[model samples]
Target: MKSTRDTHRFSATTSRFLLPTFRRPCYLDIIKTNVPKSLNKSNIFHKWTEEGQAPYYTIINDALLSDNYNILNQNMIYINNLREAIKENLHQDSIKVYRNLKFCSTYVKDEYKEGMTFLWPTFSSTSRNKDVASTFGNYTFEINASTNDFTYRTDISMYSKYSYEQEVLFYPYSGFRVKKIIPDARIIQLECVDTIEVESNSRILVPEQVKIFDAERKMFVYFYKDNEDLHWSHADTPDQMYLIGQNMNGYWDSHYRYHHSNGYFVHKGNNLWEEYQNEQFHASFQQI
Candidate 1:
């Protein structure tokens, strides 16, 4: 994820007072009466979808897009609570959602060409009603997604203040592939996919021998061929090894983190491996 300043700015002085406003009795009463009691304990979902006056959604999303650890850390409790609420309310089947944005620049239309894959680094709010989405802007995104896919999304309509909009919330770091673009309609069609799937589709070739410095572990890791299979060994635990194999797509990947985990690392190139877990970038190993 990359850091971006909030394009829509509020007064810095008043912004500090916004969060505490949610603690008021009126806000609590509204949440308690409207949302499920179990999920409303923290009122995170209500806060997230609240409109006007209390811009919790914008504040939290701005922090996420900022990619500032300190800013994110300050809001982690609310973020985690909201995540748990969404997880509890996750949709069971595939869904279609729409989002409309007023683009100040042509960066999305220009850079995100059809068939290109990209990471949407911040939490996204969408609507099940196309007409409702269109009320926001001309550049509309029509998304096809699966609950079982590599993204965490939930039907937040039941929890939203504006329930008529039929809101659906996608957590941060959702992976998307541009399926098609209708220039005439200003519409972009997107398909949800795993981040690793996108990285593996790259044309970069894996090297026979590779050494990378793991920033998270603060150690050098080595990968080499052994008995016709590629294996990796950490410098701190050289005796322990993990195997890497080519998938049906002919991309090299390894599930070294945990058994039965959907997360893994894919060799994106000779000098780089992209690690994805929980539909997000867990880490990256760069050649040292």
Candidate 2:
């Protein structure tokens, strides 16, 4: 019989939790504590090290309509149809959630006859004003089918350059005292959210910007910027991109408040290929 320790071969990647390594002290008088070390240096471990861990966020609300829920509850027809279509297109297994992001679902759109694509509420805040909120943190997801797979790349830029004035709520501990204050601050620097390359058998059209909503003379727009390297010559199926940003304030303690933007991009169609390149696109974000 194998020993317990032997049964757990050190693997840096496949292991879901942390594995600290033992090492000799580098200095005579100094000590290092809590240094996470894992075995086998696998892809998963490397990802955690480089990007930190994926965060758990609150699911603010439900995602689907009652009719859709009834359909799924009564039978597997819709799901089965979608699975078969995607499988046929990708020549592989059925669709599976990519990175296990907070909320993800699939629906059959009229445009997609064989199968549907994945959808997620891109941002946490619903403010239509670009100056209302911002988001930070970086994560990548990959969805697999039978023979092929596609990666949904999300890179939220926490650093840009923008300043605005907004009302803030100050919380006082030990009581229900609420204070409102307006301050001129760079709620968040303007950040760029661009969708990475996708991979699949079908034509996955990149996202385009539209005037989503406007109120009180404030305009909120969703637009795509073409990958500069790819000129208009490739318009129909050109390498595309989209940019969005917002500002909001979060308060946890009476003395502290945090401000950031919520901006992101998701591919619009089926399994296309988005290269998981590690190239740095811009300067590092300054934590707020």
Candidate 3:
């Protein structure tokens, strides 16, 4: 079997801190000094005070590493909140939420040979509830972990960028299909997408040009292709490789998208952003 050494188990050493802490530091002095303009223009200073005086802090110790106060795995709080919500609705404490507990990142190959980092969601639920797999016929909940709102922290710089040609990383993808789309003039300009996946029977139709475009959205798109074959095919490996692409629509003035390839991508930016991104991307190796 073809094996991909992409998916990695997260070790404690993989991260320094979460993105929020980096963007909006938890320290009061740091926030006040660095973002003085924000404080002066808005009620941020007052909000900081409110945070300091939040009712829970008086009753619960926020700094402790106990179950009640997990400084490390902040995602646990989201999990616990979900558990409580489920318990309240179902009225069953037996419904349990569990996780691998260890932090693991999946990597993939991208335009930049260096891998990108995608933080895996460690939460899973167990219940006396009916088996969804048996009833639904083995359906899977694929978290579009590539999207920014997934709430998992991603560290893209975990690996340095390299060349795709020089690096010979093997991935366990069953194969990929190249699609040539000719969209309506009114719709967005997404003409071609190369889907590298484990299982796909989708067909590819050649376009008039080596590159296809939608005159409507005014964008340039290309999919990965092998030199010899019209399609890229590979045998399934023990460890599967998943590709992630992030569309950073509005990070910069030029209309472009930022692409991050891991098991998935971790995107940043709000809903209204548009194209042209001075892209900084890397690949990741993942198992699934």
Ranking by lDDT: 1, 3, 2
> What lDDT tens digits, residue by residue, belong to model 3 across residues 1-288?
111222111111112121110111122122132211221211211211122234222122222111122342333343234223323332211121111112222211111111112111121211111221112211111111122221212121112131111111101110111122122211111111112211121112211212222234433233222211111112333123232234221111001122112111222233222222223333221111
Better of 1 and 3 by lDDT: 1
Q: Give the per-residue Cα lDDT of candidate 2 at 97.
A: 19
Ranking by TM-score: 1, 2, 3
Per-residue lDDT tens digits for candidate 1, residues 1-288, read 111223221111111111110121222222233222345623666777555664776676665543334555566666666766776766757889887766533655445578866555456777788877777666788999975677778877676656777877875556788899888788889988775565454314334555666777755555442223445667678678666555211122222221113344555555577667665777788875
RMSD of each candidate relative to the true structure: 13.2, 25.2, 23.1
Name the best candidate (by lDDT). 1
Candidate 3 lDDT at 21 equals: 8
Model 2 spans > 4 angstroms off: 1-114, 118-204, 207-209, 212-222, 227-260, 264-288
- Winner by lDDT between candidate 3 and candidate 2: 3
Model 1 Cα displacement at 243 (Å)?
A: 35
Q: Candidates' TM-scores?
A: 0.56, 0.19, 0.16
**Candidate number that wins on TM-score, 1 or 2:** 1
**Candidate 3 ranges with C-alpha deviation above 4 Å:** 1-123, 130-212, 217-219, 225-288
lDDT of each: 0.57, 0.19, 0.20
Which runs of model 1 end up more than 4 angstroms from their true locations?
Answer: 1-42, 199-288
